[model samples]
Target chain A: EKWASTAPRIASTRLALHHFDTSYSLRLGALWPSVRAGLLCEQKYGALLNNFAAADHVPQELEPLNAADFVSEASQKAQQWQRGAAVGAVARGCQEGSGEGRTVMQAEMMAQAEMMAQAEMSPPLGASISSKIKCYTFPRGDITRFRPARPDSLGLLDYYLMDAASLLPVLALNVQPGDFVLDLCAAPGGKTLALLQTGFCGHLAANDISISRTKRLYQILHSYVPREVRDTVSVTSYDGRDWDQVKGGTFHKGAGAGSVLLQVLVDVPCTTDRHSATEEDNNIFHKRRTKERQMLPMLQLQLLMAGILAAKPGAEVVYSTCSLSPLQNECVVERALDIAEAQFNISIHVEDLSHFRTLFQETFSFFSDCRLGELVLPHLTANFGPMYFCKLRRM
Target chain B: RALLPARALPAGPGPCPRRGCGEAAALRAAGFSQEQARRLLALQPRLGPEQREAAAAQLLLLGLSAEAALALLERSPALLRLPTERLRERAEELRRLGLDGGRLERAVRRSPQLLHVPRKRLRAAVRLLRERCLFTAEQLREVLGTCPAVLQEEPRTLHHQFQYAYFRMGVQQKEMVKARLFQTPFAELRNRHIFLERRGLYETPHKGQTQISNPKLKDILQLPEEDFLASLAYSTPEEYEVFKKLLAREEEEKEEEDVDALYT
Candidate 1:
């Protein structure tokens, strides 16, 4: 009904009905054109193409089929799509343009060899706390094929732009390398280009209260840095809960008197799953998941209380989001760790990113969700994302 | 914005609809923002308005800034359906590989799939690192500016990763381009250099003498196999997963004796 529950059986029934007129428009708010005219009705396109060719044998209560289970599952997927187009027109001889490009490159190499045999049937690394968090997945075949697909396009000796699961809350914000970090809603800036590719930040402010997404985060920190490592970066637009009164004074008065504001990230703004309120093109899937996801958890607990009041009393903020929504990730990091421990008396600490999974080795994959942090999800890991992050400390 | 759907836009933007004008006033007079030129012309609506003024005048004739070509097409929207004479022939083949002009616009703003790969797969990975990993063209331009996905690999898998780091870990092609060893994964650098050359903690350097103690291929491809088993294989992660399943059953019995010596 809601286009038989949010499409995604990895595209095909004619490109998932042309990604339901460009990525599921109006993501069902105002019953999206009566659910796109009951999914392009011609008597419900043979029970919505046999419920998306038995989207891996349905049942996540997507409910609705029964006219004898849609005429016996559309004649058993029209006899397995006529035995895969008669073994691809007898292995390409009846040349209907190289038999429909060898049946769409043999159904995209049998869906990438059944998603690499379901990522080699998961469940292995034991002694469980989610087997001490290992999900890596970048290029993962041919060794993260020289990584950099923009996280401010690598330079200062390719430090770390991110997505080996956003380098586990920048290795749980143990940032140090002249530490001063802050990101706080830093637009499209992949975690402030992974905290200025860690070339020992002695200062990095970055913000994004949208002056056109902080001019696309100062053209991703002047495209892969260097102008003296982008003159120790600053780029702002404020309103990260009035970033310590727009840096006028005393946010733990400059790195002294028991220093603070070392690392921050916050990374809020959510209801994401990268458009798919049916991307037929995109009206930003009902303006970012239904009318700007109803005040996204009070603006994600006011940017995790302006990244725990621009940290200092014992810095390290992290927070993060991409949103699969546990009320925008663990009820906004458990009400910003009970308002940074009872209305800023502070003394914080959360840690347990599976005790730094043997110091971030098997390229990090942590999902034991919300006792504070960790989650990567994308159908339980592969190309590591749908982030969530967590980690705090400021005792 | 009641989520528009009168047959959701196909031909709209042409006649000034309000707020900024044509091609959103030529992308807000070249520095975007009329909502980042209407969210990068609504994420490439087959880039009309004269292909977004010839892809922002071919990214200001490849010197960027028109807000860094609308922040590199808001971080590579498949480089605006490519073809600006194949983005000026992949920026003149990354300035004939010595990467000129701000290191070829920071390697095409950090990998715009290194300008849609294929130019004979970046000249067969720069002719397998200059004729079989002998490197030195300024050590393969500092290993293609510290790993530009080794110009999209496969010149016989970068000549079997430089013949397994120059003949089974005798290394040195400037220590395999300062141990970025074409960014690891010739089966996890032959299962961590044959599990530290079968635990005698490495050796192999001959002919130029110095035959025993070894380690640095950048600490065996950047450590963390549980800190290379608590600092150099004093071992355990269940004895390095039973020495990576006995070196993957001795590479499937040496690829079944080279397919039984190419069929006897």
Candidate 2:
């Protein structure tokens, strides 16, 4: 009854419901309820992979499952609704080249480390990132009756649904095919519609400082790009720490740095823990947004020093965040590499994406509990994550 | 509209995409979350009463007032993320206050001047920059975020410009806040610290920390009095026009020795 005679409104509604479990269990010590409840049951029951880059000559290791395809019958009803996707497909079919079928499924998963398929997502993250993304997934295997919010439920649909670990910071920007890229907090634009479904960028801009999330990132890059990679993108909204790559820069102007590459991404803004452990309406644990939650690590270190001061000098940059918070991921890349070498004299580093976290540890759970970035952490059947990525180059 | 559905987003705080306005129920009762109250109402776009009278004529060129800058954005929306240059070089002071459209977040948008009494004049100029300019609550939050215009002066003219830069220019509080030294004009920082203490080329940094070759107080309050009389008091402009007429006769004999010690 009014929370037991309103003792100061039940300590101000249990201090806004233990302010997101007292801020990520004080920025995740004891990985908040042990490895943050298996990365919040893979953002509540996974499946947001959609790639179909016009189904990029469809192949995806052409249906390779065999351990007698996990004794079929639709993988025993997806292993009676996932028995650790049949012990993570008998641990990626004992990392496909049986060392006695991964020492007898690692001694029957360390003699039943007590199962719910030991809180799914992570076959001990394939012993930690053999490395890390790209544009697509079906030759009809990860299955899709198409519905993550029905992209016109199918007709001339194509695909996007996203979160294949937020496509590893735009597949750790290997965007070669004549690169220019630049996403820079591009709004709602799923990595500028998966960096124009890797029809290899050559010139893309995107940007967003919210003119209505740059008109919902121009209605998701004009509804999941195409018209010749949406006529080499150009959208803008500015105010990303006064964007300007270098003296009126936008796309590797008058190209050179050993023949042009430029990329960028920067995906900042954090404390999203799946929109703060399931929305309390802008809940930065609302004790009137405790100084905007200690000024979200200096606004993700000034939008990663405005995407490394709009990089161009050997640019590659990646910097992602959904935040499990090591003060918004490795101290905002160690205070943006000491404010990009003491106030923009410019110099950047950090590249080993650990083989892109051992090539998306059979579709993500990553955690090496960060030093300079690579986080994923979501579980219960690989539900794409509490993602935190990192990669930088600019010298 | 990638064919909508992340639980149907249009919850609106911008372009009323189906009500839920009233500033997203006053930013979800000031905790924010109809998606950070629609990205803090799409970083404030409402202004139209002619862009809140041209953002109160661009916050009257930073001297405030077009109705006390629309009554301090209806009394302190956390001075919309302060940092108005004096925090020195935050991306070159937000690119010189993003040419007018920013006195750091378009003036203000209603937050809480710590529940009113006009924050007792910014908590009496941040408790006189933490007890008579000793500063440090992280240098009074980088001196109220790089000079929140010393909250409209007059607390005895900001205690006579923090007592002539902390007692007759012995300067400290980290070189009067890394020489933003109240943006020069406590009568041109006491006519450039009495023209470098009448060209014996200055000393004052006492209290036994001994050492005052003096000059770089941002080159004696940001150069130009002909580069502070040729390279910081090496002296010229005809000996700075004979030390501004002997410092205007020692400031008219200290206001005639405070009216002859107030009538002997």
Candidate 3:
């Protein structure tokens, strides 16, 4: 019931902000036309709504449709393809049944269809991002819990288990094998689960301050992960800002005095927008959002600072929030970066997010002015996120 | 030739004795799909036609629509086999807990597990909240309406939750009730309060005097742990955990002293 991120609510909030006469508001206003244009364009691609099988794992039934069948299907699809590629050969084929160089025509039609699908799936992010890190653009399971039940167990287990947007923060942390990772606000811990799935960590400390929610985190990990792997994980009930005070001094045990946390995930709480909320939600979310608007940034700044304090020199810390509010998202990141650098010598790495920004731009609406982090708007980018994230390193 | 036909495959070993019969039809009539009816029967195959009929009748008797009853059964098939007398008693008990009529229906709709909790356990939880926690019957009703899971919690857990809020935090019954203190686990509340108190950020409310520095019980408990630590406590998660352990030890020592006094 606590669905925080929804595309419609985010769109409304962003659009509502455009009315203000400030420079930021004007810039947001200017961006609205382009965003709307992009959303309108992506909606025509149709594949945005279609649930696709992974590139590697096409269904057995779907496999029988040869290149030729797909080409013909592509032609049929191309006729419906709104703009750009609706020219010459494709148009001719639509108007007239058979034409010269039919085989070549099929190939061209197939290529055009593929491009259109790619356009719908992955919008071009600008030149700021690099291509090194793997980025998945598909907004899998963002709206509903319905993941494709894959034939393979591993495929089924991992597929769409989390919002694709959430995976970026985990990646931003740059967790290495044997790295001591702490997910500070890890409740119903999708990111912790992803971290455990991705690397052979020495230990993962997953803590949620809420004992009830932590119990849920435990149940999620216990059900999905094997006991041996789950045993390697330490589930603790503690406030995330006290990142330095994990019990038994286990973080300091491995190396000399310099031993500290390698990567920390600081996904702070924020006011969320789920498009599918009811009238009751309006009252609850409005009151909650107002309180959060006042209270969250201070908490976020503190947690980010604590994250910096807990990390080793050159340790990576990823700051993230599932909110579109500039105050909670970009402003908090900016302030945290400033305070950490001033107090703890933690270097705010803009370059760290370039690759992420690139993937973000390619995948969603990428705003450049969110100085410290990448902003992912809901309808402007893909249908999944109003998520924001930034990465920093301890100097 | 490649894929096996439906009938070609051998029957699954865990076959139910009754299939496509009265219970399945009854469930189907009550708006379950064929597959769903099959799944329901398969989950609790021990449920006889009479038991299923009686359960449905009891659910109807309790004012749940056929659809609601079917949905509830499909979600929690274990409810089908619970003794009718016990089920009736529990339903009446919940009604008495101020979740009467539509509220009772909705609460069950929200969490069907509320139907399966043992009677003695439910009564004990109610008693703890009313007598020990000093919650008025109306406040107890509000707690039940808001969080029915309170009834499912162990009586000791409820007692601990109330004790921590009332004795340790000096939160009065009215404030605690309004805050829905029973919704959060006792350990979490203890950790947050202890962290704040240790930081000199929060004060324990005294009876006659105004609590100038004391944060409201609602504000204190409403925050997620990180927010409480960062905004209110101005403490770290590590320090909070360490403090929690220290506080636990302190409570143990106090309990030991009380035991010694009782013995003497």
Candidate 4:
């Protein structure tokens, strides 16, 4: 603290100088007294500290209880504080180890050595850093997939179906039981079915931008969900970018919608790069859609930002896309973060999906180096995706 | 064996004949020329009657030749004013981390500044290397012996380097130290790596896959550009040059990919 202004300059100089001393520049070019005098004297702090010119950080003071007794739970922390703060580390620890008495300077040297050996045992820096998602999954199912036994009164036309990879974003959304939910781009409604299948969704407002797409979504929801379960859903046709203008940032769950946070999902449109490469009919890579292809990431970013603004604090919004482009996936999520934090003053945290990754480990080829979310890469046998999903918690 | 040489001094140059002459005599007795003692004092003139021999003796005992020791002292005169006990204490701190006498000599010689490290920082650095970087004590000794200045870096930067090597490059600690990964700036390393990656010459290591064909970390970092291109990276300098420019532009146009995605 004393040399705070000149500390940087002194440190640089120290690097250039070997055996260079700092008694003068440090402002305390004085002799240190033996431990007995230094610790017992009124100026013990000065005597104790002056020996090391570079001792800028001192150990934090101990808690009263830790000082009195080190509980097993807090002992590790207490021990560290003791070694650094002991001022007389040599006085107590050294006395017990070696019977022969030594000079205070000897005591200090031994104490430093002992402290360092102990330091080697402390947790390493990145050791605590783990993968954002845990994984391994690929389930193969043919016509014989089992369904829950239905009650006699209600009958649905058919079961709605989709690829297992398409449902990852729904899993990433972490929709809890009885939570109000919104599926922003619910067209063709595959992910919405996955959301409903979990049996955790209470009331969901499944939406799509075009009336035509919403018509298809209604058909899918009707074919799969019985009337009793379908009553909880309200299918709407509104541009995903301006969803908050319609919902007014609050999802009214039947009657009790008071300030509860809503779980939101936006499977934004993206370049189906792999499919576009293989298919000739209505491919995004076709010359007619060049402008639309280029504009996809921007539209996705807008939809995601709206999702963030439409939710209350603690509400989670998942953004997924069928795209391999880093530009479309990671880049879009990053822009939403910047735009939300800048314009709306809303902040978002990208949650770790290690748990989801582990649950589906064998099925998806998880892409590494994705900062905001997880990407399911396409494997020939496990050809489920180019699906990218990122979960953001509004804060 | 100190890496930084003690600056050579003129044979005889003193403003005055004999004033506080004991320190000058002590250096002369320790094998420095009379002019060397004068210049060494010019660097740090604080060595006193009691401190002069002990300070000179400390360097000699660390296996430093009088010439190398004098060069270091000339480079950093502050060593003269440092208390004898502090030097012993700092040396012991490094020694405990596996920088035995020979390794310690090499590390100090390479980075004379290592001698000035605060005991707090040294402890933190060692702990971080072992715990965060996952370097075993033996690998740490090797790292210190080569790039002792790493101890002076912030923990975040050090951890980033380790992660890039471990997860991104799929390199083990032994290879990382042997490649002297810490010696190169991360930007330069990233440029080279991305160039190779984009050219389809390198694959990022991921779990549950065999990536045994990628070039060794040592060959990637230690080889000359021509050799690196000719053998491991398998690309022309022109292509590598173009890629580096594109990489820089790509990096600038977006958020930094290096920033930790993991929320704290």
Candidate 5:
């Protein structure tokens, strides 16, 4: 008596299994040559069994197959059957029955029974089974797996998922432990994460105006940070311009004194045309251009002023953005520097991002003074999204 | 230590005949030769007036090296002689200590035993040795002789070393904190919760509003409020159908409520 079941209709599962087989052979080839050497391995044997079963009748000559072939074929088929059966069992195993099968017509009673049986065996869990399978089945990727022990874990994840553009320059600036760091316009927290990663803070404070966005930022930090490091950071929801106003004095004079040396990262919002690939259902240029035009210059200027106001004497401020617009990049920086010249002695030292010089020249021709800061065009370094940055030191 | 040429010596008590002879000229004018004037300018004013005169007399008498005379002058506090060689030797000693000895000596004398230990090491040692019984060098040596290396390697010491290195490297506590926070099986579930919570939509019952009782409805619309609003703003016509249905249902309910109120 032969019993059999059809394969489940899960594209991800099929793909994962295929990937697993290929990777296993490639990896295990050196360790066990015999396993990789033979073409008719256990997997192939299972395929052979399925093919034989599909035939109407087995010929007399082929009916009694060799013992080795029969054993290999039987064992392989059983293994595949067991794994698929396990997943299906779990999906149907839920107390509430699985949803209707993908292809079952209203009149097809037989298909319904089959789907009912499968659902009964395998119950759907809210969490993706693929994630669990990835964690346990593959030992290689499991090395970095860790469980959150405290509330601050989410905070740490916000820091880790930061883009390379914001992270690299912070590393370049080389913040020391117990140094003061100010992040202006640090809402949904990419630069905030970068700053926290430095661990070089007597005090680190992040500010953003949007309450909803700040809440999201808090969630990110809560998810990502361990309890130990989470204690170091403080998030405040406030307008960047009003930071000094709220303090009732300059940050340098009030909060920062003595051993507190300032390092400020001003990552302001710009028209994010660069996220065109990731954002579906929108004309990237047309949708963002108007807002980019109106706000980039204004926000950039305000953020730069905030950074300067917050910085200690002889402190360095790194101003950055994700837009390629010269109006936002050079014009705002130049204007701010000009305004700051008389009141406070300031010097501007631009990072020579010679690596992406050609891309900047090609994409943004208006800003001839690449001397202000580094510009990373997405087309040049495919690894990073498009970004613009400049560094200013207070004299 | 080469002998001075006789002709280079001043015929009478006067400054060196060199053109840049401001201080050298003043010393020579005070009854010293050109060589003696140059030597006098370099010496400290610590020596006794008589000792300075005697040293000057000794320079004329013995013809010894300036270093030897300065060393002899340094040993005699009563000798009102400038210890130029002693000051030079002290400066060299400070350079070896990677400090300015003159400045350090002043600072040390002000607050003696001021050990300029490395900040990272000091922190590590403080954390390690905190609340432990004070052990002198003799006690530590005795302990080391008795205890095994394995026994010496305490968990506290290991923790302190790890923390110190991390602190010194400026490793952000945020990363560790985040690792503790989010990298878990439940983290993704929590993320979804946070997303929904931010939008003012939650799983629990509310007083006035109709609860989202259907599981499918809950899953499909589990986004934060801002995201939900944003989606509504730019939703496709097909997505708007559901909202339209809800709106129509609400209108019908209102009409039914009015009818029921009239009947009552």
Candidate 6:
């Protein structure tokens, strides 16, 4: 009876084991080697271990798929974000560049057109660029031209040295055809260039104390001014202050040459605070301070007195400085008034620049309500040095 | 026992840092103490009495601890001669007066009148009281208090004084009732002459033929209609209206002519 019971139990156990092995074999056939080994071990237990192992491998394979999906999603989101940012950046850049760029382009185009028109109107003097002087127009309707000189290299250097702000305002205010203009402290010839550009002057007398500076001025005038205007302009090397003693007779003789002595520009020596960026570190502040403290005010007053003597009665005298100091600005004006006394009454009126507030504020102290002249403070405006100007009409 | 003289002992031959030390030493040799020599140095530097006293105290402190104090004294010699507080106060006062103390001190050393009492007194007084005193309404009223007395005086004298004062103050009368009196031609004439001239306009001339200056047509036309034209010139209302419109057009054209001409 005991043997019979044991035999039945063993047969049942063997059948159950066979059933587990069949399930595992099917499961492991679809799996990789790693999964197959794990499933094979599970078959020995004669339980559902093979089924569990196959299920575990399913999750393992799905994990990498989930990771891949996550990576793809992240990359797509980043690309979309970058595209939006790029659009915003491009729109901002276009908005900023458009207005200023358009104005500059238009001005350049107008200048070129004016030059072409002048060339067509005038007779062809020669094939040389210098032979036919060209007119270049500004946005404000002011026209100028470059006159080329012999030994053109020197002329080019002088042209590069010219500062437009120092010359343009005086040109705009004073240039009249057949008018005699005296640029008292004319050196490097920037103002002379503008004066010649107007084609209005009967004579433009450019004077400087230094011979070398006068040579440079002459070279520049010859290079940029047309031959007709170049003949009219005379460059002289003489102390402007002592011009009364030196050139008094010559000036009187020139007066009869249809020269209506109407305008004089007194661009006196001043503290070079505007050119401080170009100066060496140790010398910059000290140099300006010395000029501001001692030398400039005296030189300015003397030059202004000389200008008054040289100026024809009822002539418009423009006093200018590339300095921000009050001593050089209104104080000098006040001193001139004092020196003039009631004998030669002169009135000062300021030009308006309300459209250029940033420019106005930078070149002048905001506290100054002196509309008597324009102060072009470079700090407030575009990149420029501080400049002060006053125009007076001698009574 | 022999008494040794301090001068007989050898002293350092290094040059004195104080300005005018040789002069001070010569004065001292004639009979002066170290304090007197120091005072002389202060005088050379043009230090004020207050500055000199403060400087003495600073010098005493430095000399008592010479080794540690020399470096700082060398950097700022002014520190050895003046107390920091007094110097700071002086500097502040100079700044308020729109002057730099260092520059002023240097100037004073060169020329002693820089600290003359009268100049300093006036400057200080102006700074303390009158510098920013913009006249109030009450003050202006005080200035104008004797207007009635002025008006009651001889009209000529009163007018002369008024003209003198006005010219002195650089005042120009934009509007005035008696404009002819202020006119340049009539300016030199007295009020009596002006009164006589006004009275003479009503009086008749005692001559066979009285000459009268003829007025321009434009001036005669500009006269008020009631004064010269209402009774004599116009018989009809239409004529008057037509004349008024013509006058307006003439005035407009005159203004336009004025506009086109350059100021120069």
- The best candidate by TM-score is 3
DockQ, candidate 3, comes to 0.01
Which of the two, 2 or 6, has more TM-score? 6
State residue A80's C-alpha deviation in candidate 4, in Å. Answer: 34
The per-residue C-alpha lDDT of model 6 at residue B68 equals 23
Binned by DockQ into CAPRI classes (incorrect, acceptable, medium, high), candidate 3 is incorrect
lDDT of 2: 0.57
Selected candidate, larger lDDT, 1 vs 2: 1
lDDT of 4 at B150: 88
Off by over 4 Å in 6: A1-162, A257-259, A281-293, A342-368, B1-264
- Pick by lDDT: 1 or 5, better one: 1
Q: Residue-pair clashes per candidate, as listed?
A: 12, 18, 12, 30, 45, 12
Superposed on the true chain A, the predicted chain A of model 4 yields a TM-score of 0.61
Q: In candidate 3, what are the lDDT values of residues A263-324, reduced to their tens digit?
A: 77888866543321212333324433556556878998888777777767777888888665
Per-residue lDDT tens digits for candidate 3, residues B1-264, read 465565553453133344546677787776666655555565555567678767767887777876687788878888888888888998998897789988788889888899888778888888988888778998888888877888889888778778878777777888887787877777678766655553334556657353346788888889887887677665556445545554566677789999999999
Model 2 lDDT at residue B93: 33
TM-score of each: 0.22, 0.21, 0.41, 0.39, 0.34, 0.34
Which 10 successive residues of model 3 chain A have the least lDDT summed? A42-51
Chain A superposition TM-score per model: 0.25, 0.29, 0.63, 0.61, 0.53, 0.53
Query: What DockQ does predicted model 6 obtain?
Result: 0.00
How well is each residue in A260-283 modelled by candidate 6, as lDDT tens digits? 765788888775543332334332
Native contacts retained by model 6, as a fraction? 0.00
How far in Å is the alpha carbon of B211 misplaced in model 5? 52
lDDT of candidate 4 over A240-268, digit per residue (tens): 88887877534543425464458899898
Q: Residue by residue across A1-395, what tens digits does model 5's lDDT show?
A: 23223322333322322332344335333221111111111111010111101222222223343112222222233344345445555544662553566234324434334434433343331110111000001011011112222222222221132333444345334466677787777888755655664455666777788888889878766655456666766778778877767742655663545866778888787755334222333323333344554665887788788787777667778787765556677778888887677565555444443322321132221223464676553321112334677777776
Give the C-alpha interface root-mean-square deviation per candidate.
Answer: 24.8, 34.0, 20.8, 30.7, 24.6, 58.1
Off by over 4 Å in 4: A1-160, A249-259, B1-264
